[model samples]
Target: MTLAVLSGVGVLAFAGFVYSGVYDVGADNAHTRPVLSLLQTMRERSIASRAEKLTLPPLHDPARIRQGAGNYNAMCTGCHLAPGVAETELSKGLYPTPPNLTREQVDPREAFWAIKHGIKASGMPAWGKSMKDDYIWNMVAFLQQLPSLDAAKYHEMVEKSGGHSHGGGESGAGHHHGGEPMEHDDADHADEAQEHSEHTEPASPSTVPEHGKPGHHH
Candidate 1:
């Protein structure tokens, strides 16, 4: 009987605390110390528990890491940042700031899970819906090696990767394509049509190279 009474009282007190309107929800200020600690503990524990059962892939492949570098720049750099990036507009505004991946050492499987399935209530977006698994893995692979690179090396790889500014392909399937999809398709079709036309045409005397072009001189 005593235990039941105590439980009822405790429940009421907890309910009163919640309904009291003393808790601040604004992002401008940090969470109260105890609440902050509680949240951190819960998030860490959950991630660790889930990661234990995961079998991680070999994340050291150069090709995948290069792919991941491009994806990260397109998708993640605004929040997590790359080497030599001092700050980002989002980094300042997010309440629990996103870590600078360039400086932070991330566990591969945990990073994969977080990238594929974003943390709840955090600013991170889930990439799995739009990206293929291979792409997600590539992002993880890039992150594993991010700490060692400088800004120049990071830029060089991303520039060469030819990934979408916002997502997977030139179509930018993961983000808005802004007419580029049809444009690209039309361009490809035009090239095909031109090739067909060229093959069927009789070569005009003036159009024939006659082996007189500079490279053809040999």
Candidate 2:
């Protein structure tokens, strides 16, 4: 009886493999339902297996949350906007749109690991090599607080948090095409000039004149 069942299963598998000729390897075509379902299942299992051994640090402090917000805004907001924040034109067309990490559905530690290691074949790239471990941990700590964060407060925290600007690719799935680098260069030059002016000595005291007078004594 067992041999008969095995034989039947083998025959079914063979038939399915050959009859499912609709498999389009073209990038333009969306994955078939069965293929998509299988991929999703595999993705979940892969995440669970890899994340099982991850050790998360305690992330209870408000400061860490604030820092994480900075990282999120500069690195993540483009791909995964805040709850009330809307998506920009560039994010609309990515093959696998980025996830909204601010939602309660995501676990902080899991989010952190995902951000640090990134998912393979997915648009997400591992940040572990680029970002410091402390930064990754701070991001995890921040994710824990995202669900409770209001738009106003999230904006404030991000504005106040002092950190380096992250490249757009870190946000999630979308690609930041060229042209932005030119804008950045111009901004950088302006910033340098402003800094130089701020520290430079004031004009000669001789140029100072008496109040309410034009080259004349008061």
Candidate 3:
């Protein structure tokens, strides 16, 4: 009788998970704790499983780091926020707010794969489809060293690599107001700082919105 009751419970729970429309697909809705935890676990496990067999070529050239920094600054820094760099107003309001790459949790291969293929349902998009293989690999090489880098180093690398980022919406690709760039009235990096505390999550090491157009820079 007890076995039968447990089986019934399992069936009902599975059915509930499948039939329930409670899962919010919107970019606006913050994930519930259980849902967020599931996603996080899935992300870690999937990366670990897949990255194990992937062999990475030696990528120690300083030029590669410079090149990757260019891509990161112009494309990723606004959302991901480089070491010691601050966030923008647009990045602040985003649900799941972008991750800080300098934190201890990020792994090298995971960073590479995340850049190349991008994450699904979150804002990360696959750069492999849009960017060339060499560029993607360069970014990977740079990410391997991101944790040890300080804010000054981050700025220097990007600037040396030819990534001169201007404030305002000009640097990014996607837009809510049609294809045209959306205008934010308060345009300083200081204004960008305002959105930091608004974030709902404690923010894991590195994150991008499931939808905010990760990887591909305009």
Candidate 4:
């Protein structure tokens, strides 16, 4: 009876605290040290627990890293700035500033999980939705080497990659993550589309519609 009464009192106190609106939710208003510490701990433990059992793939392939470079430059630079890039407006404005992955080394399993399944209320997107698992792993591969790259080497790798190409016909356009369209260079769109088309098997002549044939008249 005493334990039940204490639990009720604690619940009421928590409810009252929430109702009071004492904690500011504004981005400009930083969380108190204790609150920040608690959040950090929670996030870390949650990610670690989920990623603990993940089976890691080979993350040192040159081709994989190269592909990851282009994807990262096109998709992630705005939030997680590159080696040469000091900061971006989006990165700066976000309440929890996105990590500069260029200098930060992250555990590959945790990185893969985080990239695949974004953190709640954080600006990270679930790239797994539009990106194939292999592609996501490619990003992980690049991340392992990111901390060691200089600006020039980074740009070179990105240039060599098939820019902004998500395999299986998911183009950079029309894919919404966190309610925003994924952005890439207009010049690269033609190349990206071409790359995607190349991966797709062409329809056999027998399967082609009569009206859709090159010589067919309307």
Candidate 5:
């Protein structure tokens, strides 16, 4: 009888909350501690549960790391914020703000799953629709090496990655936006990577966004 009475009260409380419209759904405001904790628990558990079955390939392969860095610089830099890169334009405003990839290294399987299938309602987009599985794994490989690298090391690796990047007219194959996809040869990529490498100064190690710092020079 007591359990039934408590159940009835719980139902009434839920109904009151739904009808009262007191919940704030705004991004600028964070959820209450309890609510935030609950959501975070759910997200982590869901990823762990889903990713447990997948086998992770060797993530330290140099070729794969090079390929991943290229793709990451082209696509993920704006939000995931590359090594030595401060919070980017998109990262500044994204709710739950994308985690700093350089410091908080994720498990390989979890990283792969998240990259292939983005977190719901986050700015992250599922790349499985447009990207190949190899490309996704390559990005994860780069991420595996990310935490140990400072700005100079990170820049040096990318610069020396031998024309693998698709950005800055280096490739015509991948997700190029707004520009015509004209096929370019290795010579073209080499020239562009060299040019891109020469003029660029490796930035200092960026401060992790402790309190929503804003500014993007990348």
Candidate 6:
């Protein structure tokens, strides 16, 4: 009888708290220390648990890292600032500032999983929807080396990567937009296509939605 009464009161208190609308939900309002700690712990445990299940691929390949440089520069720089960049307008306005990848190194498994399936409510987008697993891993490869790179070296690597290639027909190959089929002529991009084929089968070209554009927030 006592347990049931306590439970009922607890439920009522929670309901009242919800209805009060006293807690601020605005991004400008920062969470209390306790709440922030709880959230950080929850996020870390969740990522660690899920990341344990992923089988890591070889992430030290030079070609893969080079490919990743271009994608990272084009996609991630706005949010996760690069070696020379301190911050951007987008990064500044984000509720939780995105990590500077140029200063931090993440575990390959965690990086791949987060890149593939983005964190909930965070600015991170699930790249897997528009990108293949192999391409995501390529980004992971670059991340492992990111912390060691200075501005000059990072630019050089990106330049050699040919810039913003998704490695799965989303690069220079025209996308399937406006009901048009993507045209990939082997004669035109024979070398590029061949290089991409070495990693994974070519994915049919599809337009990435505005929200699904490749970028990592964590």
lDDT of 6 by residue, 48-116 (tens): 999999898888899999877767765677688777767765677776677888898798898888888
User: Which stretches of candidate 1 lie above 4 Å from their native place?
Assistant: 165-218
User: Root-mean-square deviation of each candidate, in angstroms?
Assistant: 13.8, 14.0, 11.3, 11.1, 9.2, 9.2
Model 6: per-residue Cα lDDT at residue 213:
28
lDDT of 2 at 119: 80
Roughly what TM-score does model 3 have, to 2 decimal places? Answer: 0.63
Q: What is the TM-score of each candidate against the true structure?
A: 0.74, 0.63, 0.63, 0.77, 0.69, 0.75
What lDDT tens digits, residue by residue, belong to model 4 across residues 1-218?
69999999999999999999998988877889998999989999999999998998888889988887767766777778776777755778898788989889999999999998988777788888888889999999999998999877876677676666567545534322121223346655575456546655311111101112243222
Q: In model 6, what lDDT does residue 135 have?
A: 79
- Candidate ranking under TM-score, highest first, comes to 4, 6, 1, 5, 2, 3
Task: Encode model 5's per-residue lDDT on 7-116: one tens digit a residue.
Answer: 99999999999899898868788889998898889989999999999988888889889767656655666677766677754678888889989888788899889888
Candidate 1 lowest-lDDT run of ten: 202-211
- Give the total clashing residue pairs for model 2: 0
Model 5: residues with Cα > 4 Å off, grouped in runs: 1-9, 160-218
- Of models 3 and 5, which has the larger lDDT? 5
Clashing pairs in 4: none
Q: Encode model 1's per-residue lDDT on 1-218: one tens digit a residue.
A: 69999999999999998999888888888998999999999988888888777887778888888777666765666578666667655677897989989898998888878887789888888777777777788888888888988867876666555443224222222221111211225565576446434443211111101112233211
Clashes of 5: 0
Model 3 lDDT per residue over 1-218, tens place: 69999999999998998689767767777888898999999988997888776677667888877676666655665567667646654467666777767665566677667877788776776766666667777777777788888877765565566442222222122312111123334453344344433543211212222333343233
**Candidate 2, superposed: residue stretches over 4 Å from native:** 1-29, 165-218
Residue-pair clashes per candidate = 0, 0, 7, 0, 0, 0
lDDT of 5 at 41: 95
**Measured by TM-score, how close is model 4 to the native structure?**
0.77
